[model samples]
Target: MQITTEVVSGLERRLNVTVPAQRVKSQYDARLKRVAKTAKINGFRPGKVPLSRIQAEYGQGIQQDVINDLVRDTVFEAIEQEKIQAVGMPNIESVDVNDAGLTYKALVEVYPVVTVNSFDGLTVERQISTVNDADVDTMVDNLRKQRQSFAVKDGASADGDQVTFDFEGSIDGELFDGGAAKDFKLVLGSNKMIPGFEAGIVGMKAGEEKVIDVTFPADYQAENLAGKLAQFKINVSQVETAQLPEVDAQFLQLFGIDLAPNEGGIEKLKADVRKNMEREVKSSLRNQLKQQAFDAVLAANEIEVPKAMIAEETTRQRKLMLQQFAQQFGGAQQFDESMLPDELFRDKAERSVKLGVLISKVIADANLQVDQDRVKAMIAETAESYEDPSEVIEYYTNDKQQRAQVEAVVLEDQVVDHILAGAKVTEVTVDYQELLKRNQQQQG
Candidate 1:
């Protein structure tokens, strides 16, 4: 076999391979002999069919198989001979199998050579957070709200009241599509509906009928409804008042705190909640620092990632989003791929690919390896929140795939730590609530 190579623009190369006609004939004849061993045809027994007869009957498919095998067999050797690191599978094209030779082209993306001077000059912020008593108090209030109950009340609905009503909305005196409902339940202050829609129901007594004007926000998701004036004709069927249980034995017990008549069970509950909050705060702090480290490294590096890697990453991200949607909405097969265009994930994918290349370089230069002790500790921390942590730990420990996933995360954390070690780090104290808010905004 003889090989020639061409650089087809950035990161892409084409390998032209040609096996001599004699070699092609040799492989073809060998395949024909193998086929004849299992050959079955009229007036011929197995292993007795003529090679020429088998070739005549199945030459087309056998030729394709031979070319495919040759392409697989020779392309890597050609790539090695060219001394280029290929990223993914080569796309074979311009295949020709005949008297002259078996010739083809394999187009592939070559991996770029990565270099980094130093992360020492990179600046990163170390988030310093302490989950205080006030945050714990806020969390306690939220927990109470979660366990809050509602009761049927014959009175005006106010903020926090659950209201069941029927309403038909109209624009310009004409009812619009999806502008009506019957016995739709809503919390007056939940903001589940458009601006003014929920507020309009506040203080509305059961059995009251009214029409209120509402203007959709200028940035509303529906173009037709955005900034448009609409009036809703509403009938309030029922209003239910929220009832939060007092901090008593039952409420305390609801949180696994066994209250004693003369003891400070509420304080005990707050302490327990505070411990959980502290755990969350610790995790949040680590995540914030890791993110900062990643941003520092990414900002400091300029790398050109292969489009093929970006494309693959984009596809993986799209499929992950679909999987999440399937878990949330229960219809994986019903989703249309076109709903999520590749453009939606392209930029993120490119950034991720670039950052991945940088992270890999850091790992290589630092000679980093996955720490099994940290892996065990991370797994233990994760399983701590479960009812039966031992079972969860056992499940993860015994499942190689799951354990490897955790190990990968551990190594990523180590990578972040190494980067931070080299970075000009400064501690920034952030309030717990402020940190949470910032995290939410960043995620969005």
Candidate 2:
């Protein structure tokens, strides 16, 4: 066997593997002999089939099988011999089989040699914020809204009011599927219905009967109803106004605070809310800082990521997106990958691959390892959110993949910390609300 490799382009290698025809013939003959020992033939007893008959019947198939096995085995051997750190599976360009030899060319993408520059010159701004009493009050207000109740009102429905009604919608004097409902409850400003639907229901009083006209948006999901004016004969049954729960002992107990300690549980509840808020604020700020550091590192270093790696990452992200869509829309088995274009995720996949390469290099250069203490702490922190903290901790400790994911996160944070240690970091103090608003904007 002889093997040779040449560069096709950036990170791509063309490997030529040539195997002796005698080797193929020898293997083919050996497999035929083995098959003949237990060969099944209609005209002859089992194991009594002649070699000539077996060769005449199964020679081509046996030879092809032998060649496939030989090629797969020899390709890996050649890759090992050449010390090529291939990314994805190799593409066989062509195969030539002659009496003299069997030769094939494989196109493979090798991992790029990544060289990360020093981070001393990189500058990243770290935003710091504190969860003040006002932030706690806002969180408490939001929590109260979450636990709000509703009371049927005699007056007209308004914004934030829940109205229950029976509606029959028709377009062009013809009723369509899913155009009618009985006793459907809708919030006036929820926007659950199409444009003008909620607004039409608003200001309607209980026991009122009215005909509301709405025109569907041009980009509506239903083709039959898109841009069509529809009339809904609505009979409003009841209008309910929202009533937020008072922050008292019952509410505090609802949040697992059995004892108040002092100040009629309000102080304790505020303290707890403030603590959680502080933790969340700190986490968000750390994430922002880490992302900035990651961007800085990438901007400082440039490396050609292997197309194979990017392709693999793209496939992974595409599958993840499909899974999320399936989970959200309830058609996991029926979802088609074609619905999502590759171009949609190409940029993100490329950046993810590049960052992965850069982070790996940083880890190697800095000799960073996953800290067991930090891993334990992370597990504990995660378990805090679950009902059974010990069970969650046990699950992480026993599950290798889950633990590895956590370890990777911890290791990435270590890399970020290492970068921040040497890099010029500017501390920017931002208001808690402003920081949260910025985070929301970025997420949006």
Q: Which structure among the candidates has the greatest lDDT?
A: 2
Each model's number of backbone clashes? 0, 0
Candidate 1: tens digits of C-alpha lDDT, residues 144-191: 888989999987899999999999999999999899999999988877
lDDT, residue 324, model 1: 91
Per-model TM-score on C-alpha atoms: 0.88, 0.83
Worst 10 residues of 2 by lDDT: 256-265
Model 2 local distance difference test score: 0.90
> Which runs in model 2 stand beyond 4 Å of their true positions?
41-50, 165-184, 189-237, 259-264, 325-331, 334-338, 383-402, 438-444
Query: Pick by TM-score: which candidate is best?
Result: 1
Cα lDDT tens digits, model 2, 398-440, are 9999999999889988999999999999999999999888988
Q: What is the lDDT of residue 304 in candidate 1?
A: 83
Clashes of 1: 0
